[model samples]
Target chain A: MAATMNDVAQRAGVSVKTVSNVVNGYPHIRETTRARVLAAIEELDYQLNVAARNLRTGRTGIIALAVPELSLPYFAELADSVIQAADAQGLTVLIEQTGSRRERELEVLSGARRHLTDGLLFSPLALGDGDEQLLDVDFPMVLLGERLFPDTVDHVTMQNVEGARAATEHLLGLGRRRVAVVGVHPGEVVGSAGLRLTGYRQALEAAGVPWDESLLGEAGLWHRSTGASAMAHLLDSGAAPDAVFAMNDAMALGVLHELQVRGIRVPDDVAVIGFDAVDEGEYSNPSLTTVDPGREQIAETAVRLLVEQIADKRGTHRPRRVYADFRILERRSTLPA
Target chain B: MAATMNDVAQRAGVSVKTVSNVVNGYPHIRETTRARVLAAIEELDYQLNVAARNLRTGRTGIIALAVPELSLPYFAELADSVIQAADAQGLTVLIEQTGSRRERELEVLSGARRHLTDGLLFSPLALGDGDEQLLDVDFPMVLLGERLFPDTVDHVTMQNVEGARAATEHLLGLGRRRVAVVGVHPGEVVGSAGLRLTGYRQALEAAGVPWDESLLGEAGLWHRSTGASAMAHLLDSGAAPDAVFAMNDAMALGVLHELQVRGIRVPDDVAVIGFDAVDEGEYSNPSLTTVDPGREQIAETAVRLLVEQIADKRGTHRPRRVYADFRILERRSTLPA
Candidate 1:
């Protein structure tokens, strides 16, 4: 049987309340008593039952992180960083995959599982501006990604537009006209794709290059296969682009692969750049030039904000929006040197 | 205030027990009564309190997945597959990062937080065979990766040896006599690295090639940076090999990057192969030839076994060791054609 508070108390020849006070770090306990209780607890190898303690304090010391998918390198890296940051705070993370489905995301918001976690770190890919009212939950939550809701909940977001603009400008500065973009979600106006598209257009306009509809490659899901197919379609249409900007590194990788398969040399024939400085980009053939969206900073800030919110018993703090910085990581894909 | 069973019962004009039975999908309820109860539930937007239910029944419908790290592409993809497979069975996964530390891995085994999870899907990188006694925990757990125990718990493993042998033979078939290996863990005997090294040696013997000690590159961590460093060390030490096999895809990618940096042409100068057919391999420049260790299958089977163990009221099942099949994916890295 697992050791109990009573067992520790008996071992220490003290009252259960005294042992509890010691365990809870009560300041009133004498150093000698605390040491005795600790030694007893150590001898028994007692682990305080977190679930049972949660019932009393209403805090499980667990934070739920809901992401679209871990298969995506971006989210995977983000998760890794979050877990690391949370570990520093002595908290464990519980991951939930919503599969970027509206129904599933909604379920996560309304589900009773919310009580099992101290707070939630939600990165909603499917929930849009229309679902803003759902953010008004009783529990603590910090929103992630580009979906900007009303300032009713804390949000940690990447500088999507700024990052994309930098990437597009890098390609345009390479003296390449007719720049094409892959992973343009059709009719998207508020998500990462839409924001990046706006940035791309802004860069093109600044470079005195007119936006061409023929240069846009439509992609619903930003998977490698989708990126490959989109690149193939762009090539088949005979609308040659001197430069290409894939929204993310995965798609950028696909574009590079497709170009290689078609005997088109990167940077020489078509300069390419991408967003999300995933580790995979560093080793891709020719390497990838990408916008590093300060993923570690974002993860750290989100965890810090969420932990603060969880500890705020008064619940009087207003929601705040924070954004991470971005920088272009130049590599061989965009520049030969 | 959230609606309770009593509120639902009163709204449906039925008893609380009947309402609970209806909510629990009791088949004996009449169609009219079920409809009325469901309507009441809908009207109240009632959600089942999983925490309250867990307190009563000690089941949270949440399984914990303890992996070494999510930053590694292999573990991230494996986690993705496990989450997908669990979702299909209506189970949610909680991820715990052990950071590949032995103390952390042991802490996970004895942690109080384990009570919050129905079972654990543990993928240990730090804990070795000597820690087998720790597997005697009361909770249901399915072991993943190597580090086999004495049949104390269910284990899901990949065919590391066979897969490595096939990869080596593929390079040998290309008439490459000297094949260098990357990501060899020092003093490993039964782990994935050790098993793969054994397979490499077996293939060398089968092909009548001599094993050179200098050809082995030691890597403490099977990460891309480590892979690059190991490859660089090999190159600087003048250990020239016609082909290279990295223990995992991340390391292979690093090797490829290093070779490119050194102006060495892949598949022409030194053929490269990797284990673990991660998605990154598919889009890598020259692409990557790798062993597909049936990751999805392993995940599905692990989840199935875990779920079964969770529901095993009799607790009569014996520990089973299951291996997933492996197939060599012929990509551009191994063969130019």
Candidate 2:
């Protein structure tokens, strides 16, 4: 018979949970306790096979992450961090792409297919306010990103509003009273764009500057091309603000590309800033000054929370929302006072 | 009463293997035979509740891909394509990260975790010559990438050697005799760097140019930082090569950035090229000239092969080696003489 975690725990006079914690490399556990657990395992010659142990817990030792796509480096890096977190917990990750379509997102929730995996980390893109029914899903799910649905579920979001406010205020502090906002959707009250837009408005009002509708460049999809085209539209309309703030880094890149193409020097002619501390943002032509939303932290927290839920299958914890921090990284794109 | 595959085969006057082939989507099968099998399945309403159908097949309706890491855009996008291709064939993919470690790569092939999936698509980074025994494991497996181990398994490889030859020859054709190579090891005999170096030598010989060992810059890890560091080293050594070829696009981007930092213009001062057709490569400052090794074809072929192995328990016609095509994408990074 194979030696089990219980055998090691018994030999060491410690609980089975302590052995598990040691094997998992939990950050909070004491080094002495971990040493003791390792010694006991050596004495017992116990092999801590995660798959075998998880089988007893009725888990496949696997977790699934359903995201819009990995073609976008933002989601790609996020998935990488999530996989790292899961791997530390001895859980393998299975990724599924739903194309951000609401129907497809809902199908993954339905769990009609094989449920060999323990839970899902979902990031829904094309889902909208009307799809609130998906919130009542029974399976363990951790929703990522800033799209708040009507139904209740565990969600992880960035400090979009606060971050956006900082971005706008930075331009204002640079004495750019007339600042252009890229990647905006008018009259919207939720989502990352809407929340960031509200923050932008709050910043302008707080700074005693009037909000001009002409300075609000609405780019329907928050992509690089949209940013470039919207910047072109803003420049063509003669609403030349002193500075610009794009809601996301990709848009910021598009804006930077457009400015460079039109022979306009960044910061000197038009200061530019973006949201999301994307790696590409750091290496952009002028190195964009942007908001660094804590993407990795959110990914790690979501995985830990899911593992907790999986461990305590019947435990009742109210569905909670976690908001990660955001910081402004001032690089070359933005003008300094 | 539930009907079995054998019953369907008997009723349709076909061999059991033929019935299995029809069910698994073998491309070589005749259309009429497929129709006859479909007719039998319809007569029985053979629902594809693969979840319940294969309790006895001892195979999970899942395929696993073990990659070194997803932090690299090449691996990330490769995993994405693999997942999409798997989905098209009505299969799910479980991705395991090896962190490019030898131990983790071997752990993934242990075959003890049998209940989770039916087949595996493995991409090993650190597995050396001694680990060739892994190829003989008793499971449905498909190896991917440029690393060629002892041959006892189904393998899919990108055109690393030939693609490198073409890239080197292209640069040489532009009258660049003294060329530098980034993301290379001094004497690596295994994996991509070694194979591509061989191809580079072949191109140099074919062009009647002597291979200068000084031209090979050391990049232990083919990452962006390594590329930047390698370029810096090359420049500081006062041996300015006319052109540079980095192994992959991300590292190439790093080279491009370093060149810009030193006030060296691209395609004019020193032309540069890279492999891997990443989206960012297309949108780089001057765009990137690189090889588009058939990533999509690899995904489709791997998934199709894995699905066949899963549906065929007897393991007939197990594809040994699958080679995909490679194409050169002409962009602003490389210019013609």
Candidate 3:
């Protein structure tokens, strides 16, 4: 049989609670005591049965990150950052892909799987305002992405409106007019697409450029294929805008590919800008100009908030909302020189 | 109090074993009994404590997938496929990123965290022959990627050598000589880079072409930046080849970006091909020609094998090896017209 906490405590001549404090990384343990406990554990080759400990203490040292999909570069990069941040906190992340389905999102919230992890970081793409009450669960959860529910859960989100406005202003500042927007979800007022479209309108109004409904290209999903189809629709309809701002880098890439297929020179015929400064954007054909929404910061903040909630066994802490700063990353796509 | 198996059994007018079978998703249970037990469970809102169930039966209904990183498009896509495959089996996946570190890989093998999941699908990049013995663990683990260990764990891998050879042959068949290979790891004999390099050499020899040492561009990591730097080194050293074969799609993208920066027209000045037919390859400037190594099939096969191992509680099954088929995807990068 493997050595237990009692064995380690006896070997180190310390109390079982002390040994547990060291094992659980309870931060306040003394250096010499921690060293002695560690030495005893090493001497006995004691492997803590995480499942049993979790059953006893209700802390698994694992957090679940529920995202729409990892195949999407945005979520993949976000997951990477979250994992790195969680690792720094001596925690591991269990990824749950909801497939952007409302039922799956709801299932993730109320499923028995919640008992397996201490906290959840949820980024829902499909669940809307109607499901806001679903966030009122017993577990600790930090909401991510553009979806917002007031006074319900802790939220770490990007400045979607400000970032999109900045991206449009950057394109307009480059002496380009008649800016077209790709990835606009018509009638959406709260989601990412709608919020970003509002920002685009704000930038256009600030620059004294009238908002043309024909310049708004609709996309159901913020994917590359959707971006390509939107760009195709704009070009085929002869609503040729001098500038185009895609909702995200994935869509921007599609727009670039479609433009290239049409032999249109970027920054020469039509300048392009995107949101989400994904790694692939740096290596894209024209090296995509995009908005850095401080994804790493958002990830770190969200993990920190979730960890705090998990640690707060009393459940007295109030929900908080934090927004990551955003900046425009100027690249070859918008700048010729 | 929440409903226990006994409570569910009593409420459903069935035996405890029948309720257990229904709750465990046993296929042999009668439809009427299943409905009664499910109805009782819903009436009581009984949430099965996964931690307690895991402690009792030693089954967490969770499988872990340990990969190098998800930020890499290849692994991200593989993870997506794995999740889909696992979901079909009514199992959830917990992802662990090893960051391709040997110590971390070893930690994952021996860590107490192993008890938290039913099985593991490991894809180690840094571990090699010296660590093959580590595969002799008590838990069920299925190995993925090019890292192979004989007579040990079950492996589901892509045809690295054959795929690379076909990629090279495709480039050669395009009437191109002096093919420069990018993303070669010097002194590697067993990993993906070395095996792919061997295939490149075999293709050159088969085509009556001599192996040129200068044509090999060494990269420690198979990333886009490495590919770009390797391309730049080849261009600066005046060892310009008519064709370039990147070990993976990420590096191929880098090669394309670098080639474009040098004002070099693809297929006219230089033809390019890459391995791993990732989604991004289709949207690249010239639409990357690549070797599709059957990644989705590998994921599905690996998950199925892992599930089988998990179901074989008696430890009666022997280790097996499986390889997915590979094919070359022809695109505009290799054929200008």
Candidate 4:
């Protein structure tokens, strides 16, 4: 039978609560008493009850990372980065998929698992406008992707608008007019899609290029199939585009496939660029050029801020907002002929 | 201040232990006593301390799903399936990436997080030969992928060998005599790569086709970059093949991309087929004909098995091995000209 706290306490000639305090790494215990307790625990082979320690210290050494879904390559890669970053901090990650749904995101915020993890690194896609109050959670949390929450929460985000502007400017500098854009969320003025769209418009405005409404492809899900259908719709409507800027790599890959099926040559008949420098983009047919949104830095910074919050037991640490750097990764898709 | 167990107990005219029992959902508590405790808790709006309840009941209501890496589309999709399946059982899933490294895989078995989660759904990519003893962990665990552990542990695996045989046979049925196989691990006889190789050989034997040594393409990591390089090596070596059977879809997509870059027409020159019906396969150029390894069934079955072990406090449940079904999904990549 495994030795319990009572056995360790009896062996160490101390009270059970004293033994628990020592096991939970309480700072008030004397060095000699701690050494005695540790010797007793080693002698009796006492396996500390993690639940009991967590109950006393309120530290689970685990964190939750909530994303839309893992099936999307960008999210999968982001999850990969977050997991690695959390691992470096000696933290375990619990992943929750919101499926980009409003109800699921709400459930994540108020879920029973809140007590199971020490903090959460949330990247919400659907919670916006009226859902600001939901971010007023008492638990230690750090938001990722964009700052859509109250100022009291720490956040780590990317320069979505600037990245999109650079992508559009790259296409415009290549002497291509009629720069089409994929993935517009209609009236959304926040979030990734909206900010990236604004960036595209800014680039077009700076270049004195007319904003052709026909070139704007509307894709709700930003999925590959949707991107393909959106491209097909634009082409079937007799809209000729010399270049396209997909909002993400997944959608860009789909757009590339659609153009290939229609017997159009990339970088000749049409140039393409995508956002989110996902690994899949590096191996795509012509390879994809995309925006490097400093994902690793975002993940590391988010975990660091969340750890800081978790460690601030008295709620003394002020919330911080950080934006990771961004750059354009030029590749074959947008290269000169 | 929030109400504690003592407050609830005093209000219900019972011992603090009785309130703890009721809150932990102990089965032996009398209906009247349970109702009184519940009423007191509701009247005081007491939030049950999950940690305290967990210490008493020894259940965390969270299971861990450990895989190699989410950057791989197969594992990402598998994690998604496992999360959904675990959610159906009202269980939270914690994801751990092992990176297919031996030390990390071993660490997962003996990690401190073992006590924090109810059980583990482990898919080890690195623990081969001489590492079987690590699976003898005290906690409840359900193994995924091929069985590499003792018979004392429950296992849920896919039909690797049979699926590969079907994939190879499909290419043979297309009148392609030189059906090259990609992603081969030399001298391997077990695991996914080895089993799939055996199936390929079996298909070739049944078809009475001569085994061409030059037609085998070797790839170590089964990644897109490696797949593309393997295809380039095979093509550069002057091994003219009429058809190619990639071991997985990621590599298959790479092969298609490489062919496209070389201006070689797919299906017109060399038909290609892949295994693992990932969603990306549906959007790749010419799409992809691959094997669907019943990933959802594997995930659901694994979670069910793990939950059973977790619920069986007496350890009375015998370990069982389950194999998910597989089938060939025909797509545009393997269409007849």
TM-score per model over all chains: 0.94, 0.82, 0.94, 0.92
After superposing candidate 3, which stretches have Cα over 4 Å from the reference? A1-40, B1-22, B25-39
Error of 1 at B92 (Å): 1.9
Provide the lowest-lDDT 10-residue window in model 3 chain B: B1-10
lDDT against the true structure, each candidate: 0.89, 0.81, 0.90, 0.89
Question: Candidate 3 - CAPRI tier?
Answer: medium
Q: In candidate 4, which residue ranges exceed 4 Å CA deviation?
A: A5-46, B1-46, B147-150
Better candidate by lDDT, 1 or 3: 3
Comparing 1 with 4 on TM-score, the higher-scoring candidate is: 1
Task: Name the lDDT value of residue B144 in candidate 2.
Answer: 90
Put down candidate 2 lDDT per residue, A105-196, tens digits, no spaces. 87788765434668888888777666788667666788888888653778888988899999999999898988999988776777777899
Better of 2 and 3 by DockQ: 3
lDDT, candidate 2, B1-337, per-residue tens: 3456788888888997898788878888888889999999889755343433344455566788888777787888898899889888878888888888878877888754445677899988888677787768767888898888766788888888899999998888888988888888766777898888877888999999988877887897777778888999999998788899888887888888788778788888889999988777766666789989899899889888777766777767545788899988988888774
lDDT comparing candidate 2 with the true structure: 0.81
Off by over 4 Å in 2: A1-58, A236-238, A335-337, B1-55, B316-319
The DockQ-derived docking category for candidate 2 is: acceptable
* Residue A151 displacement (Å), model 1: 2.9
lDDT of 3 by residue, B121-226 (tens): 9998988867778889888899997866777789998888888989999889978888999999888888888899989999999999888988998888889999
What ordering of candidates by TM-score runs from best to worst? 1, 3, 4, 2
Please write out the lDDT profile of model 1 over residues A1-337, one tens digit for every residue.
6688999999999998999899988899888999999999999988776666776777888898999889899999999999999989988888888889988888778755766788999998887767788878888899987776788899999998888888999988888888999999888888999999999999988888998999999888888888888999999999898889999888988999999889898889998898889988888888899999999999999999999999997899899999999999999999852
lDDT of 1 by residue, B168-280 (tens): 99999998988999999878888889999989999999988988999999998898888889999999999998899999999999999899889898889999999999998
